[model samples]
Target: MRTAYSVETVRTAERELMDRLPDGVLMQRAAAGLAAACADLLRRRGRVYGARVVLLVGSGDNGGDALYAGARLARRGAGVTAVLLAAGRAHEGGLAALSGAGGRVVEHPSDTSAPFDVLAAADLVVDGITGIGGRGGLRPDAVPLARAVHESDAVVVAVDLPSGVEADSGEVVGEALRADVTLTFGTYKPAHLIDPAREYAGAVGLVDIGLGAVLPPVAELEALQHADVARLLPVPTGESDKYRRGVVGVVAGSARYPGAAVLAVAGALHGGAGAVRYVGPAGDAVIARFPETLVHAGPPAKAGRVQAWVVGPGLGEEPGVRDALASDVPVLVDADGLRGLNAKVVRARKAPTLLTPHAGEAAALLEVPREEVESARLTAVRELAARYGATVLLKGSTTLVADPDTALPVRVNPTGTPWLATAGSGDVLSGLTGSLLAAGLGARDAGSVGAYLHGLAARSAARGAPVSAEDVGAALRVAWRDVSEEA
Candidate 1:
């Protein structure tokens, strides 16, 4: 798993390293790593022998990294040019290195199209604009330059990170540099792992600057690998029978939206749960799709005992859902269940509760605007956990899970794709997680494992094109096989 710490944590780590390492030692290492990455990219394109590189140099240390890296590339037969955005304020040492290495510094482009021309002609463009020190949106001078970089055919490589992006928060405010590959110093930042900044940083390249140890156990989102997910999965032992594996009760669907129940059932049936007990208005539809499910109509009271209860998908504000929430069992609340949910009810519950909400629902539950939730998903997830006293899962391009009470690490699911935004996707994920929870995994493991499997299943189902909810459920078997085989 790859974890990202907040800017404060990184700053502390960087300060500690600066105190220990010799002066400019860390910068040299960072520059060397950046140069190596550029070489790798050029080699991959089969034009390392004569590739032309453009460096958009700003005033800060970020620009210094790019300039020093350009010197390295210039000595290796690659043509390099640096356009000094801050003419007089450019890093003196970096500029001297470039000039000494036969690289020239060109005047900053006054015409908006000039940078685009350079970017279009070059094989790769190095973005050395603002670093983590930047606040708000892109600066006026950098906005057009950024847009050109993003639209150009040339690959962009960001130094440290993509500029104008919130390094600690995943929020993308105004114009931001979009890099094909981002070579970062020290460790990963929240922006590198979370979206929409994650989208801008296409592929992350971390350079170990020896700042790893000093960083606090920061609140962050993490993406799990196959081995990690496999480790968290629960398998049946010799003494484990059907009941021993555990039962998951599902309270979902309404008379109006029966497919939610069907899709949820589909996920639960293939999910690690030994048996899935369904209680809702859509019993017939769920049974029609998944005959293996134990269906019950009326209420959860009539539904047989279960290790965990999944509520809310397609619930549609019915009174029975309130009763289901009142139960003292491990429960997952989603969709309609998140609407007007009381904090007292969650606090009063005896069983552990997991609440999964999308941006809009999360905003509603927290009494904030949807834009606020989207803008600060990290804060929103943490806020939800603290307010409701439950494990909160905020679903988006980067799915984040945070447990309340302790400052434990948050899990940011890496396997999800934008393609997973299809209808009934969230329902399927909830069922899979509930199944895992019922099968004896803790809340953290269940949520993380569910995310990992869901992403893989979506990729498998798509197979290159669009896929329906049914396809995702069908593809779960293949995803499971793929993980098991890897193990």
Candidate 2:
């Protein structure tokens, strides 16, 4: 598993390393990695013979790394130029190395956009702007320079991190530079993993400066790989019977939308649940798809048995839907269920409750605007979990799952395609998670497993084009086989 850390934890680790290492060792290690990456980018294109390179140097060590890296590029027969933001505060050693290696320095860049014009003609741009120490937005002099680099046709490679983005929150302030690739020191930051800012970091490359010893669990979310998810899936033993496998109960759908019942049942059956109890008005349609399902009329009270319950797919905001949710059994609330339900209902439940909300629904639960939820997904999901005293699964381009009691890191689902956004997708996920919960997984595990499976199923269903919800359900069988074969 790839772990992400907060800015504070990384800074503390860097400080510890700095104390133990020689004076300039850590910085040199960082500069060496930066130089190697720049060389590789040039070599891959087969065009470093006389290519021009521009470095946007800031006031901190990030700028120093870029300046020094420029020196290496200059020595390799590339024309290198440095646009220094802080003329006097620039790293003395880095400036000397660049000048000695035949790299030119341009001071007072704001005097003219000439440096930007030259930067536009360069083959590659390296942003060494404000690093992890930045508190506020970009400085006055750095905005237009960033815009110029952004507007350029060159392949942008950022040193340390993309300038003007929050390392911890992945939030963009003022003007942020978007890079085609980012080379970071030590370990990965939360912004490099989460959304919004993650989008700006086109492709991320990590350079180890050996800060792993003190790295804490500061990663807000992580995208699970195939092997990891496979280990989490339930594997049946020869001694185990159907009863030992676990039974799941689904309280969903209505006469108005029978397709919801079929889709949800499809997800549950493939989610490793032994027996599925269907409690809703669309029992006839569910039975037609999976005759093994134990269908019941009325509320959950009459429903035969359920180790885990999935509530609120198609059941509208009627009083009956809320009544069904009253059961303390492990429940996954989604679609219409997320609309009117309050945190009090979730807290009152006896079993663990998992709430799955899309961006708009999450905004409603938090009483914030949709834009705010999308801007900082890490904060929004954690807030929802803490407030409701339950696990929250926020669905979007980057899926995030958070638990309330412990800050045991959120999950960033790496699977799924745009085709997965078709109708009835959440319904499929609700069934999958409910089945996992019933099969004895904890709230956190259930949420993570469901998301992993759902994304994989979507990818399997639609190779490239758009696919229907039914297609996704049909593709689950292959996903289960593919994930199991690796084990």
Candidate 3:
């Protein structure tokens, strides 16, 4: 799994590593990695020799790193120019090194002796306006320079982080640099993994500076790898029987929306469950499509034994919701079933509870605006988990799973495409995760693995074309095989 740390934690780790090393050892190491990455990029364009390299130098360590890297490029036959954002406060040693290595230094971008022309025609532009310590956004004076870089065709590379983004919260308050790649040091920052800021920070490259031993093992955010998901997947054993594998009970779909039942059952069928017992008004519709489903008309408790229950895909405030929630089996709540949900009842249940809410549903649950929930997805998901005492999966551009326990790391799904925004996709996800829960995986594992498979299936099915919710459900088996067969 790939992990990311908060800015404060990274700073602490960097300090500890620096204390044991020489004064400029860490900086030199960082500069070396940055220069190598720049050289590689320049080499890709043909040759590093005579390549125009422009560095936007600020007053921080980030700027110093850029300056030293510029010096390296100049020494290697690249035409390097440093545009200093801060004149007097710039790193003296770095400036001298760049000048000594035959690199030109320009003081800001003015109408007279401006480096705007150089920046426009440069092969590569390195953004060093701000680092992890920067808050809000870019300064007023630097906004024009940032705009100019964006308008240019240069492949922008951000040093450490894109300027004007909050490091810890992944929030882009105002103007920020959009990089083709970000070369981060020591460890991955929160901005590198989370959304908004992550979108601006295109492809991230970690430049290890020997701070691994000093950094904490716990990561604030984690993206599950193929190996991690494979381990959590349930596989049938020699001793496994129909009853032994697990049964998932789904209470979904109303007469008004029978398609919800079909989509949900479609996902449940592929979720490694031994059997699916569906209890709802759309039993006829479900039986018409999938005759294998055990259909019932009444409450979920009377729908025979089930290891896990999925309620509320198209259910319109039905009484069956109460019966399902009251059952001893693990329960997954989604769509209309999540409406007017009682937090106390969910918390009182002995079995695990998983809540799947999109931004609008989550907003209703939290009594906040939909925009608020969408903008602050991390905070909304975490808050929902704490309040309802259940595992919360907030689905959107990025899917995040948060456990009720705050100490546990939140899982962010890296797989997914914009095509997943189709209607009824969440229904499919709810059923799939419910089946996994019945198969004996914990709430967190079920949610994370289910999301992983769901997103992968969507991508595989679409393959760059527009796909419906049904296509996503049908591709589940393909996704399962792809993960299970991995060596």
Candidate 4:
């Protein structure tokens, strides 16, 4: 699992490690890594010997990092120039080192156009205008410089994080600098993994500064890798039978949208479930598509036996929402089932409950604008989970699964692609996750694993082209085997 810590936690860990080490040791370590990465990038573009390097120096240690890295690049025969945003407050030792190494220094001019000539000619730009401690956005004085950097053809590399994003919430409230690459230290931050802010961070590279021994065991966010997903997936033994493997009951579709039933049943069949029992008005449509499904036309209460229930996909004005919610087994609620949901009723349930909502549906449940949910997904998901006393899977650019216990790390699905944005994709996810729930994984694990496989399947099916919901369902076996092979 790839984990991300909060800003406060990282600060505390850094302070602890700094107290024991020499004064300049930690900064030097970071500078060395940054310089090496910049050198590699320069080499890839051409050669570092004659490359033009520009550093945007600020008033903190972030600027110091760039200055020290600039000195290293200069020693390697690169033409390095430091554009100081804070001429007086720039790191004293860093400035001295750069000057000793024959690097040029240019204080930022009041007129932003003055730096345009140098910025335009640079091969690489190092952004140190702000760090993780910065909130809102860049200072007004630095806006023009940022504009100049963006207009330039140089490859932009941000220090720690891209300037102007919230490290803890992954929210970019105002204008922020976009990076071609972001070099983070110690561990990843929530901003590096969640969306909105994540999009600003292009490619991320973790530069270890030996903070692992000091950081906490549990992080604020966790992204499951292939091996982690493989471990969580359910595999049947020789003794496993249809009933023994687990039965997933799907309460979906209606007369208005029969395809929803077929898609949900398709997802459940590929979700490692021994059998799928579907109950809805579109049983005939579902049977036509998947003859293996055990179809029932009655309410979910009389649908024989099932370990878990998936409700609410294309279920317009259906009656099974209440029936499925009232069941004692684990349940996954999505689409129309999310409408008119009561927090008190969900909190009262004994079995685990999983709620999957897109930004729009989540807004309806939280009584906020859809834009707010998309901007601050981490906060919204946590709030929803706490309010409903159930696990939540907020689907969008970045899929997040949060448990009701806020102390646990929110799981972020790293495998997501924009290609999975088809109409019935969420319906497929609801069924896949419900099957995992029936197979005995906790709500958090079920949601995370389900999202991982769903994303991988979508990517495999799309292969960079447009893919339908049915294509994603069909690619589940391929995704399962891909993860298992790596394991």
Candidate 5:
């Protein structure tokens, strides 16, 4: 699993590490990593010896890292130029080092035309305009330079994080610089994993600087890898039977939307559940599609025995939502089932409850605008989990599963394709996650592992082309085998 920490936690760890090291030693270590990454990028494009490298230097340690790195590149016979946003306030030690290494410096002009010419002809641009602590976007004087860098054909590499993005909340309050790759130091930040800010960070590269020894074990965000998901997946033993494995009841669909029931059942069957017991108005549709499903036409309580229940996909005005919630087993609520959710009622339940909501649906539950939830997904998911006292899986480009416990690190799904935005995907996910719950995984583990498989299935089904939700459901077995193989 990959972990990301808050800015405050990372700063605390950095301070501790720096106290034991000699003066300027830590910065040099960072510079060495940054320069090596830049050299590798340049080497891939062509040769690094004659590459034209331009550094967007600012007034803090971020700029100093770039200046010292540029010196390294300059020594290797690359033409390195440092475009200082504030020449007077630049790092004195770093400026002297660059000058000593025969690197040129160009002060950012008020007119901005000179920098535009330099940026246009550059082979690579290192963005050190702002560090992780920067918020509210770039200053007015720096915006034009940022725009020029964007217009240039150079490969942009950001130091620590891209300028203008909130490090802790994953929020881009104003215009932010987009990078081809962002080289973060010590530990990952929240902005690198969560959306909004994550989109600006094209590809993230973590540089180890020995802070792992001092940093806390628990992080602000956790992204599960294939091995982690594999461990969480339920595998049947030699003594396992149909009932022993687990039964998941799905209360979904309506007369108007019978396909939702079929899709949900498809996902449930693909999940590691021994059997799927479905109770809804679309029993006939589900039976026709999946004859293996045990169907009932009434309340979920009468749907035979089930270890867990999935409620609310395309269930318009259904009475089974409350009945499913009333059950002693775990329950997953999604789509229509998410409407009019009672926090007190959910908190009082003996078994765990998982709520899966997209941006618009989450906005409705949180009583905020959809834009607010989308802009700050990390905050929205965490707040939703705390408010409802349930696990929340906020589905989007970057899926996040937050546990009710505030201290636990929120899990982020790393695998996904944009093609997952197809219809009925959430229904499939609800059934899959509920099946995991029935198989006895905790609410957090079930949601995170389900999302991991769902995303991988989508990617396999899509393969750079448009794919239907049914295609995603069909590809779940491939995703399962892929993860199992890794384990």
Candidate 6:
């Protein structure tokens, strides 16, 4: 699992490590790693010699890291220049080191052609304008320099994190640096794993400064890896029969959209469920595509013995929605079923209740605008989970599953593609997750593993081509096989 820590936790760990170590030891270790990364990047183009390296230095330790790294580059014959954002408060030690190593300093860069030209012709630009401590966008004097960096063809490497991003929230409040690669120090911040800010942080390289031993065991956010997913996946044994393997009951589709039932059933069939019992008005349509499915024309309660239930895809506010929710089995609600949802009813349930909502549905539930939900996905998901007292999976560019209690760290789905923004995709996810729930994975694990498999399958099926929901559902088998074999 890939874990991310909050800024408070990171600072606490850093301070603890610093107290035990000698003066300048931590900073030196960080600078050495930063310099080595720059050297490697410079080597990729040709060599460190004669390469024009520009450092956008701020007043913080991030700038210190850049300045020291630049001094290392200067000694190797690279023309290193530092453009100081805060000329008065720059790191004194880093500045002296760079000057001693024969590096040039350009304080308070002008908007004129000279500074612009220097930035434009540079082979690489190390962004140290702001790190995790930065609150909003760049300062007024730094805007032009940032613009020049973006306009330039030079490879951008961010120090720790991109400037102007909320490290803890993964929220890009204002103008932020977009890097080709980010070399972060110590531990991974939440922004490095979550979206919006995560998008700005391209390929992240962790520079271990031995902060791991001091970091807290509890992470702010967690993402499951391949081996983690493999362990969570359901497997069959010699003693296992269809009933023992677990059956998933799906209550989906209507007279208007029968295809939703077929798609949902398709996803359930591949999610390690021994049998799928589909109950809805779209029974005929589901049977046509999957004859293996046990079809029922009645309500979910009458569907006969199911380990878990997936409700609401194309349900269109059907009365049977109530019956499914009242069941003593785990229930997953999606699409139209999420409409007019009651928090009280969900909270009253003895069995686990999982709510899957995209940005719009999440907005409706939170009584906020869709843009608000999209902008602060982490906050939105957690708030919804807390409000409803249920496990909530907020689906979007980055899928997040929040634990109901808010005590456990939220699970972020790392595996996904832009092509997953198709119609009926959420329905497929709902059914897949329900199957996992039936197979006895907890709400968090089921939702996360289902999302992982769903994304992997979508990528496998799409392969850069346009794919339908059916294609994604069909590819689940391949995803399952790949995970098991690879593990």
What is the lDDT of every predicted structure here?
A: 0.85, 0.84, 0.90, 0.92, 0.92, 0.90
Question: 355 in model 3: Cα distance from truth in Å?
Answer: 0.9
Q: Which pairs clash in model 5?
A: none
Looking at model 4, how many pairs of residues clash?
0
Q: Which pairs of residues collide in model 6?
A: none
Whichever of 1 and 6 has more TM-score, that candidate is 6
lDDT of 2 by residue, 338-438 (tens): 88777887887777889999999999999999999998888999999999999999999888889996558887776778889889988888888888988
Better of 2 and 4 by TM-score: 4
What candidate 1 gets wrong by more than 4 Å, as runs, is 109-117, 217-219
Candidate 4, residues 344-432: lDDT per residue as tens digits? Answer: 99999999999999999999999999999999999999999999999999999999999999889999999967989998988889889
Query: How close to the true structure is residue 402 of candidate 4, measured as C-alpha lDDT?
Result: 99
Q: What are the candidates' C-alpha RMSDs?
A: 2.0, 2.0, 1.4, 1.0, 1.0, 1.2
Per-residue C-alpha lDDT of model 5 across residues 1-487, encoded as one tens digit per residue: 8999998999999899999999988789889999999999999999889899999999989999999999999999889999999889999899999999889988886555667788989999999998988989989888888898899889999999999999998899988999999999988999999888999988999998898999999999999998899898999999999899899999999988889999999989988989999999999999888999999987888879999999999999977989999999999999999999999999889899999999999999999999999999999999999999999999998999999999999999999999999999988998899898988899999999999999999999999999898999999999999999988
The window of 10 residues in a row where model 6 has the poorest summed lDDT is 108-117
lDDT of 3 by residue, 337-455 (tens): 89999999999999999999999999999999998887677888989999999999999888889999888988899888898899999989999999999899999999999999999
lDDT of 5: 0.92
Candidate 2 vs candidate 4, lDDT winner = 4
The regions of model 5 sitting more than 4 angstroms off are 109-112
- Per-residue alpha-carbon lDDT of candidate 6 for residues 1-487, written as tens digits (9 for 90 to 100): 8888888889988999999999888888888998999999999999999999999999999999999999999999999999888889999999999999999988775554666777989999999889888887677777778888899989899999999888988888778888999999888888898889999989999999999999988888999989999999999899999888899999999898888888889999988878999998998899889999999988777779999999989988566778888999888989988998999999899999899999999999989999899888999999999988889999988899998886799999998789989988888888899999998888888999999999999999999988889999999999999988998
Model 5 Cα displacement at 119 (Å)? 0.8
Error of 6 at 86 (Å): 0.3
TM-scores of all predicted structures: 0.95, 0.95, 0.97, 0.99, 0.99, 0.98
Q: Which is better, 2 or 3, measured by TM-score?
A: 3
After superposition on all CA atoms, how large is the RMSD of candidate 6?
Answer: 1.2
